[model samples]
Target: MIRHLVLFKLGEGVERDDPRVLEGVDAFRSLDGKIPEIRFWELGWNFSDRPIAYDFAINSGFDDADALRRYLEHPEHQAGVTLWKEFSTWVIADYEY
Candidate 1:
C-alpha cells in the first residue's frame, strides 16, 4: 500500500472563510466518492496555531504507485488542485507501507 500525504499553506492574505477556499475544500472532500483510484481519503483544515503548521492537510491511501498516479491525474482531483492553486501552496510525500 501507499500513503500519500499533503500539507497546504494558504497564500498570504488568504482567509479560510473566503468563498473560493470553501469551494476548494468542498471539491476535495467530494473526491472520496468520485475517484475510484482513491482507496482512502481524509482532508481537513488545520486547527493548530503553531507557526510551522500548514493550513490544510490531505491524508490518503492507495493500492500502489500507479493507483496514486491515477488519483493525481483524475479530473476531479485536478480540478480541486486548480482551485487550490489560486490560493494556496502545498507539499506532498508518498511512501509504501
Candidate 2:
C-alpha cells in the first residue's frame, strides 16, 4: 500500500476561519466517499501552535501508485487543491509499508 501524508500550513496572514479555508477543508473531507481509489482517508486541523507545526494534515492510503495517481487526478481532489492553493502551502511524504 502507499501511504500518502501531507502537512499544510496556512499562508501568511491567512487564518483557518477564513471562508475559503473552511470551504477547502470541506472539499477535501467530501472526497472520502467520492473517490474509489482511496483505501483510507483521514484529515484534520493541527492543534499545535508551534512555529514549526503545520496547520492541517491529510493521511491517506492507496493500493498502489496507480491508485494514488487516480486519487490525485480525481476532479474533487483537484478542486480541493485549487482552493487550498489559494490559502495554504503543503508538503507531502509518500512511502510504502
lDDT of each: 0.94, 0.94
lDDT of 2 by residue, 1-97 (tens): 9999999999999998899999999999999989999999999999887889999999999999999999999899999999999989999999997
The TM-score that candidate 2 achieves is 0.97
Model 1: what TM-score? Answer: 0.97
Q: After TM-score superposition, what is the CA distance of residue 26 in candidate 1 from its true location, in Å?
A: 0.5
Give the Cα error of residue 27 in candidate 2, in Å.
Answer: 0.1
Per-residue C-alpha lDDT of model 1 across residues 31-66, encoded as one tens digit per residue: 997999888889898999999999999999999999
Output candidate 1 Cα RMSD: 0.6
Q: Indicate the worst ten consecutive residues by lDDT in candidate 2.
A: 43-52
TM-score each candidate: 0.97, 0.97
